[model samples]
Each structure stands twice: as C-alpha cells, then as structure tokens.
Target chain A: MSGSLQTLSDFLQCLIVGLRLGSVYALVALGYTMVYGIIRLINFAHGDFIMVGGYTLFFTIPAMLAVNDKLPIWLAVIVAIAVCALVGVTVELVAYRPVRKKGTNMTALITAIAMSLFLENLAQAIPAIGPNYKIMRRMFSNKAVLNFLNISLDWTTLLTILIGASVMIGLQLFVKKTKLGRAMRAVSEDKQASVLVGINVNRTIIITFAIGSGLAAVAALMYFAQYSTIMTTSGTMLGLKAFVAAVLGGIGIIPGAMLGGLVIGLVESFTTGYISSSLADAFVFLILIIVLIIKPAGILGKNVGEKV
Target chain B: MMNKNTKLKGYLVNTVALAVLLMAFLILNANFKTPFYSVVFIPSLWQISYLIILAASLNLVLGFLGQLSLGHCGFMAIGAYTAALLSLYFERAGIFTDKKAPVFIVSILVSLLAGGLLAAIVGIIVGIPALRLKGDYLAIITLGFGMIICNVINNLPFAGMEGLSKGSAAASLYKTGLGFGNTLKTKYAWVAIVITILCLAAMFMFIRSRFGRAIESIRDDEIAASASGINVSLYKVGTFVYSAFFAGIAGGLFACCNSSLSTASFAFTNGSILNSTFIVVMVVVGGMGSLTGSMLSAVLMFLLNYVIKNVIKASGMPLFVQNLFKYPMLVYAIVLIIVIMFKPKGILGTREFSLVNTIEYIKGKLGKKAVKEGGSK
Candidate 1:
C-alpha cells in the first residue's frame, strides 16, 4: 500500500475501533440519560449493573459451555440481561425509592454513591470474586472478516457496531411507537402530570430501569469480549465515561447519547493511537470539560434555564 | 444581654477546651507504650484529624456554598504528592542539619504550606470553569477533573515509577520510598491533631464572617445574592479555592501520617482516602455546613472503621469469615446509605454544637419551670 493509503487505512481502523467502543458507551449512556431524565438522579450504581452482567456471564457461560460445547452466545446474553434487569429493578425499588420519595437531590445522589460502593465492596468480599481482575472467557472468535489496503476488520467489532446500531434503532422505535414509551416520555417530562393521566408512573419507572439495565448488560457483554478482563471496580470508570457520553450527547436525549458516545470513543481512540496512550483518559476528561464549558446543555441537549 | 461579652466568653471557652484536648493528645503521644494508645487511640486520632480537615473542607463547598464538588480528592492528591515529593527531596538534600526538632517542624510546615498553595492554584484553574456548571453537572465535571488528575499522576514519569526499571527512558525523577522516615513518625500525631483543630476553628470563624455570609447567601439563591450585590461568581470561586486549600492541607497531613504517596492513594477507587464518594459520605453524614457535626461524624466514622477492621483481624474465626472482614468499606457503604435514606439532613442538620447554645437552652428551661411553678402557687 502507498503511504497515503496506509495512513488512510490506519485512520479507518481507528474509526472502526472508535465506533465499536462508542456503541458500548452508547448502550450504557442510554441507561444513564434515561434514568437522569426521569428521576433527575444519576444512578451511580448503574455502571455496577454492567459488572454484575459480566459476572453473570462469567459464571453461567463456563458452566453451560462445559455441559454443551455448542451453546449459543445469545443464551448467555439473555440470561445476563435477565439477571441485570432484576438487579436493576431491586436497586430502584430498595435503595432509590425511599430517597427519591424524600425528594432531596443531594440525599439521592449520596444514596446512589453508597449503592455503588456497596456493590463494589460486596463483589470484592465474595469468594472467587475478590479484588483481582479476572480474564473473561472468549465466547466469540474475534477473527478478521474483512481486509483492504492494509486495514483489517474483526467480526466482533462488526457485530458490536451492528448490534449497537440495531439496539439504538430498536430503542428509538420502542420509545416512539409503543404505549409504554409514551408513558416513559410523559413521566420524564412531568411525573405528576403522568400520574394524573392514569399512567402507572412507578411501573413505568421500573420498566425504564429494566430496559436501561438490560442495555447495560449488552454493553457489558461487548465490553468484556473486547477487553476480556473483569474487575470489581472496572465499571466505575466505564460508568463515568458513559455518563460523560450521556452528558456530552445532551443528556436525556436518546440520539444525543449515541452521538456523544461516538464522539468520546473516537476522541479516546485517536488520542491513544496518535498521541500518548497514557494521556487518553486525560484527553477524554479534557474534552468533557471543554464540551461542558462550550455547551453546558451538551451537544444535542437543549439548554433549559433554572426558574426562580 | 447577648453581646460582644458573650461572644468573647464563647471564644475563650472554646480555646480552653481546645488546649485541654491538645494536652491530652500530647500526653497520649508521649506515652507510646500502652497498646490501647498505640494501636487504637493514636491511629484513630490521626485519622479523625485527617477526616476533620477533609469533611470540613468539603462542607464549605457542599453545605455553605451549595455546590457539589466530587473532585475534592483530586485537590487532596495534588497536596499529597506535592508534600510527599518535597519532603522527600528536602530529606535527601540534608536540609535538616543537627537541630532535629526545629528543622523537622519547619520542613513539615513549609512542605504542607507549599502543597496547599499548589493545590489552591489548581483549584482556581479547575474551579473557574467547573463552578460555572451547576449541581449534578458540576459534580460530574469535578469527578472528571479528579480522574484526569489521577491518570496524569499514574502516567507521569516524575511519579508512579517505584516499580519500573531505571534503564527505561521513562524513569521517574525521585525514588519512591517504601515509607517516610522518623520525620513523619506516629509521635507527630499530636501535630496533625493540633493542625486539624486550628483548621476546624478557622472554618468555623470563616462561616461566621461577612464573607461566609455572602457565600451562604449565594448558596441560598444565586440570583438574589447577585441582585443584592454579593458578587456570586467571586464568592463561588473564592469558596472553592478556600475549600481546596484546606483539602490540600489535609492531604499533606495524610501523606505525613501514612508516610507514603502514590496515585493509588488519591484515585477515586476502593480504599483510597481520595475516594470522592467516601469524602462526600463523611460530609453528608456529618451534616453539611456544620463544623461540629463534621468533626463528630469524622471521629465516629474513623473509630467505626478502625474498630471494625481491628476486631475482624483479631477475631478467632474461620478463614472465610475472617476474609469477610477485609471489606470494611462495605460497612461504610451501608452506614452511608442508611444515613442518606433515614436522616438526609444528617445528625446535626447544619446545626453546630456550642457551649453558649447549651447554656442558654438550660437557662431558658429552668426559667420556664420557675415561672410555671410560681403561676401554680
């Protein structure tokens, strides 16, 4: 390949990696934005749900694969999603419900932080799941399916992007076309109004958490597959980055999360590829700070003034 | 009449109480042979003092300023690394000549001040843009700033190279010591305790000052405060800088006490003093905006942590059961969650405990009873 072609391919490879990473971020960010939109509380433990999902797959996949070598990847994913959704609902109902009822934002935020800490410590305390990082069993063969001009694309990356796109589109359709989606939008816009209009507000909120957490599980599967290591505290940074993506995308807007995730993922990949890899995290945060300063409402977020 | 005389009396009483407490700590430090003093009291005292500085500094932002800053630990890290590195350099340079006592005191004081000043400068840089964002947005931005700070420290060639090979091009400037020497010995726990008391007093006085009132007004309502000519932006930035300054000092003291500094010590991960959530938990549990509450809660929480960990270690239990004790943070998390859920306003609910208030309350109750008795007669 020519030098220019090499450079182009390198850029394209980075772009591909960025999209794959961005999709996972987008999945997590969707949950974050949705929760923030409805409850005005950042469920800091939402990221821990991803960790739980990974662990679920870690434990279940190995056992099932041993019994039947031909076990489908989707079964493990389905099981993980179910487990994560249940965990999400329990967290919402138990730790978050009372704090939200109290209607104190600081309290709610602190409670969320506590939940994050609790989950992390609990995981660390558990036998065989201590503080050490565990290598994930590769469920999918990450073979390159396409190669052109010195650039190769892996099947996992393609599937990740494809799945991410499909999920985003599916979420968009679900929110736009379904009755529950309308209720979710209504509750997010005005809880009291939604309640008055005969919408089961509590049920809708639980469903939102379930859906968001299910997406997190999917994100976790993709994340562990890519990185192939799981730590109790891994979700903390991932969650923070996803939260930033949500905010970057103009939090509370669905499309914005997707866009923000892509931007963050791209920035991170380019920084790691072109600049110092050590500075990638710093660059990501710097971008967040700059984006927040330039557009406090986020890239796609509408600026709303606080009323007296 | 409740006037300057009463205020002066309150100050005098508080000073006397502080002096007595200092003397007690000095006596304890001098008598290092007692297992109770060495193992339980000294460690807990130093931790309490460190926490007081952290919790109180965070309160200035969370409570008085009504701005949530999740990156307080970032400032603390700046302080820790700066102080640790400087003290290490000074020790290596043989700056402390024969006069051990005075030199040690002066070096520690200088390193701490330098740490605080550097951290305050960073705070100003961070706070300028960060303070512009409100509420949760501000919290997340501060958090990002904190993670960025940690990442920088972890990757920087100047630090975090304790384990790396020397021949490598990225070798650090200073050798990462296993621990600080006699310079930061546990005997200096009294010094930390005294500094903590002074910081608490300063914060208490600042909150009562005109500037503090201006800051509080801004917290109450920024639009109204600005309308009332209280430069909201200036106060917001000023308060953040002030808070960061103290948090930096606390970090300095922490480095001195622990005698080691690393990016791991300052990151927002599990078991780090720089864990933003843990600091926030301390502030909230102490009751935001109340110095007394912060101090009391800090002491209580530190004791709880120390006692629980020690007890678990000493207990004659199975390996599995004993292993569960390794997660003291789980207890902290549970306590924090309970506090948030049951008593969101915190134990003191922004109310400071004062001798004057206690005296007045007793007097009022006695007078009311006397009046009631007389009426019945």
Candidate 2:
C-alpha cells in the first residue's frame, strides 16, 4: 500500500468515492440520531429497513420493466421508501410502543435487538429472499459524467451524492420550519412539557420512525448502486457502520451525524486506498474512540458535562 | 436479611443438590448413545453449563451494575484463544505429565486461570472510559471494543510460537478438533459442569458481599450512592472486570466443549450475534440481576431451541412450522421479542429461587391444610 498519492487526480478520485459512500452513511446516521435523540432507543432494526428497501427494489424493478421496456426508477424509489416507512412505523407500533410503556430501557434495548433479528431472519426464511446473495439488476449505467485530467466522477456516485444532499436539506428545512418539526424539537427537549402543551408525543415519534425508515430506504438504493449484490447480512454491516457514524457525530445532533458519517467513510476509503485493507475497520474504531475521549459530545454536538 | 452462617449453609445445601442432579443428568448421557442423547440432550447440557457461566457473568455487569454491554463475547474470545493456546503449548511440550488425562487436568486449570486473568486486564482497559459514558453511550463504546477484539482475534499473529500453526484466527489453537479426543468421554462435560457450579457459586457469594451490595446501590441510585461514599467508577469498573473474567472462563469451557477453536465460534452479529445476543437473551429471560434465572433460562432456551430444531429435522410437521424452524435464529428472535413483550420482568424478576424456600412453603401449606380440615370438623 502506498502512503503517498501519485497525483492530485488520484486524491480527487478518492475524495469522490469517499463522498459517495459517506452520503449513504450520513443519511442512515441521520435516522439513527433522530430516533435515538427523541426516544433514547437504539433502533437496531433501522439497518434492516435498508435491507427491506433492497428487497423492494428487487421486486419492483422487474415488475415495472415488465409493464414497459424501461424501468420507472423514480417510481420504484418512491415505492421502496413508502414500503420501508410503513414497515418501520409498524415495527414501532407493534414491538417498541408496548415495551416503552411498561419496561425498562434494557427491555426496550432487548426488544430492539430482537426486532433486528426478526427482520433479518424473516428475510432468510422467505424462500425468494433466503440467505443467498441476490445480484441486483443494474438499472443505471456507470459512466463518467465529469472528467478533469485523470480525475473522473461516475454517474452513480454523482446521483448518490445528489439524492443524499437533497434529502438532508429537505429534512433540515422540515425540522426547522414545519409545525411537526417544532413539535419534534419540543418533545425531545422535554416529553412531559410537550405533552402538557398538547403535543401528541406518540404521533411525533411515529412520524420520526417513518422519516428514519424513509432515509434508510434511500440509503439502500445508494448501497445497491455501489455494490450490485445484496445479502441478508448486509444490513448488519451497514447498520454497525452507520451506528458508528451516529455515535461519532454526537448521538442526537443531525449535523454531527452527517459529519461523523463522512469522516467514517473517508477514513474507511483512505485506509483501504492507502493503508492495509484489513486495518480499515480498526482504524475507524480507533479514530472514534480517540475523538470521543477528547470530545465525548461528538463533533457539532454541544457538550454537557456529567456532574455526578 | 440472613446471617453469614445461614448463607453459607444455603450455599452448601445448594451445591449438594446441584451435584446430585448434574451427576444423574450426565449418567443419562453416558449410558445412552442414541441420537437424541448425542444430538439434542448431550449437546444441550454441554452448552447449558457454559452458557450459564456466560449469562451469569453478563448479569454481573448488566443487571448488578445497571449498564448494558454489547461486546461481552470479546472477553470470551480472549479467554478461549488464550486458554486453548496455553494448554496446547503444555500438551506440545510434554511438560505436565506423560499421561493424557493428567496433562489435561493440570493444563486446563492453569490455562483457564491465565485466560481469565488476561481477560480481566483487558476488561479494566475497556471498562475505564466506557464506564464513564453511561447508558447508551457506554453500550456503543463497549460494542466498539468488542468489534476491535474481533478484529484483533481475526488478525492476531501467532505464527512465531513453536508447534503452533502460522496465521490468524484459529491458527494457534491446540488442534483442529477434540482435545484428548474422546480418550475421556464426557470429560469436557465434567469440566463444564464443574466450572458452571463454581462460577455461579462465586457470583452468589460476590453478590452478597459488601462490595456487591455497594454495586447494587450504585445501580439503583448513582448519585446517592456516591454521596454515601461509594466509589462509583471503581465498583462499576470492578463489576465489569469481574464479569469479563468469568466470561473468559466460560470461553475456556466453551473451547473444551468444542472439537476445535475458530474465529467463527466467538463471532459478533455475523453469526446473527450468535453467541453474544443469545447470551443476552438468556440473561433477559432469566430476569435481570437474578443468577438463578440466568442459569435456568440458559438451560431452558437451549433445550427449547434444540428440541424444536431436532423435531423439525426428525419428524413430519406442517411445512409452515418447519419453514419457521428452518432458520433456528428466527425462532430465537421471536422468542426474545415475545418474552420481552409479555414478561418484561423476566421469569425471575431480580428474585432468587431456592429449594429451602420452596420446601418451607410446601410444609407450611400442608400444615395449613391440616389445620383448616380440623377447624371444619
């Protein structure tokens, strides 16, 4: 492995690749941050939502292509997102709500893990989507949309970044300007206060789940774009990484998650690109631990010292 | 509530009862070479004993300390590799004794101790900063450490040691398969049961100790405990270390139970959090903070899962049920979810079960029944 880059083009290429992958992680991390911030539950099943999205694409692409010679890629994307949102909300209502009301945080945590297990293993149990790697049919071509010197950015990477940016911006504005967004902010700030003020806490939480799952859906599409194959275990790996992103960027802050994801993706890409490939995961964790020890609140997150 | 004298007596009586029950259980396995014994019952017992150790150890951290740790299997992996490697060295060098059984006896103890001690040291390193984080942050940190342990195990270089295979992961193991290899049938089962008994007893004793009481206090009210002069971090980290040590011992017993040592054995979620998550399931099902519950649930869940799997394979069943059982892990998920949803306090709910209490309750009931009959007459 070369410690030094041969050219600026190579550096730009690495940067582009990192951004493309980082965007997907950022989107997922945002979902993680939102639900965790509001409810204080680590939704382990959040990653399975991505897997659900992948399966949706698996079903929809051919169906749409059958109707016409061309695939309605945008329509498929929308459907996948909707399906994932519905599944996410349903899981919350069925599994989490009951536990939240009556059980301890540990019980809730266990429930989350079980839900994750349920989703992945359920996929494996289904004959069509059993524990085998299913190759996704390529709907888009990988061609260089922009080239400068030796630096070239492909269409898939460009699309992933654009879609990620648009979703994030839209989410940011919605949270800042919308009535529901203020209610979400107020609820996270103080649930008791929010309820006293006539805000429907449960509804806000359900909406958050829907939005988080929706982000996972978009991330799934990007994940498929990057790698043409999907497997049952893919969610676990992606979930773990996005979780690292969530923890790295401050646990509750949106910008922190975004920053954390990009940093993780860059660390991973650069480590694989310049250092030993086997060491990439170790390096990411090492960086996370170091940053956390130095700034436990995470980047872009406000620090609150533990007095007791 | 009870004096030390009574507690010691209780511990002793419990040990005797356990010894009798476990021995009879083993006798059944030794006598029967049937598929049910070999495939379902025997393996379930072997797994139950060590899993009891794992669940009890995790309870020390999660239940008593009130902290969630997602990476406990990392400690188990550390123990498994260390103990396996050490015993292998002893076996290869011909140091302990010429006889195979004697060599096994001597090396296993030393190796288990070494494995546990090393795991404790690593636990301290992982516990310090992680303990400070608290709640969910602590969980993620522990999870990070666990992943790092996995990465280290999968990539650790053990090639330079003489008589050991070169490479990462399972390379440095004693051998690819059974140690002492059926020379002593059910030998590892004996090792597992003995260790489980010893570990569970130790946990029982520790939980009653003054430090253990302090640890429980911290769990209930950290600030209040700290105000009362409890060393919160020390106790928290101590409990964490204690848990890690036993988890390592469980790993050693785990290595003994298996034919070979491999990275996959201590895998994280890639195996569906195979060893890690299920161990947590046992703790939860047993009821948090209850050692007895941990042991019972480990035995019960393993039996249920194994039985259902074997039945699916051996008997005719509806395709739907068989399909559900096709992935055993799916059943585990469903089991965990349902258990939490319905019995959130778990089967025991921080309460310990004892034969003495049960006998007394029965005696009182019979006496009451007799009195009621006389009064009616």
Model 1: CA > 4 A from native: B97-99, B162-184, B272-274, B316-326, B359-377
Share of native interface contacts recovered by each model: 0.78, 0.60
**Model 1 CA lDDT for position A283:** 93
Q: Candidate 2, residues A175-252: lDDT per residue as tens digits?
A: 999999999988888999999999999999999999999999999999897798998878877888898999999988
Candidate 1, residues B125-195, lDDT tens digits: the string is 99999988998879879988998988877776655654222322232333332133343445666678778
The best candidate in terms of TM-score: 2
Instruction: Please report the TM-score between candidate 1 and the true structure.
Output: 0.93
Q: What are the clashing pairs of model 2?
A: B177-B259, B269-B273
Score candidate 2 by TM-score against the native.
0.94
Q: How well is candidate 1 docked (DockQ)?
A: 0.73
For the second chain of model 2, what is the TM-score against the true structure's chain B? Answer: 0.90
Residues B1-377, candidate 2, lDDT per residue (tens digit)?
78888777886778789879888967865676766555555565667777888998999888888888888888998887788778767766767544345656767878888889889999999989888777777777787888788777666666223223443344444553224444343545676677777888899889988988999999899999999999998999999999999998988777766656666666557543346766777788899999999888887887777766776867788887777688887887888888888899889999999877887799999999999999999
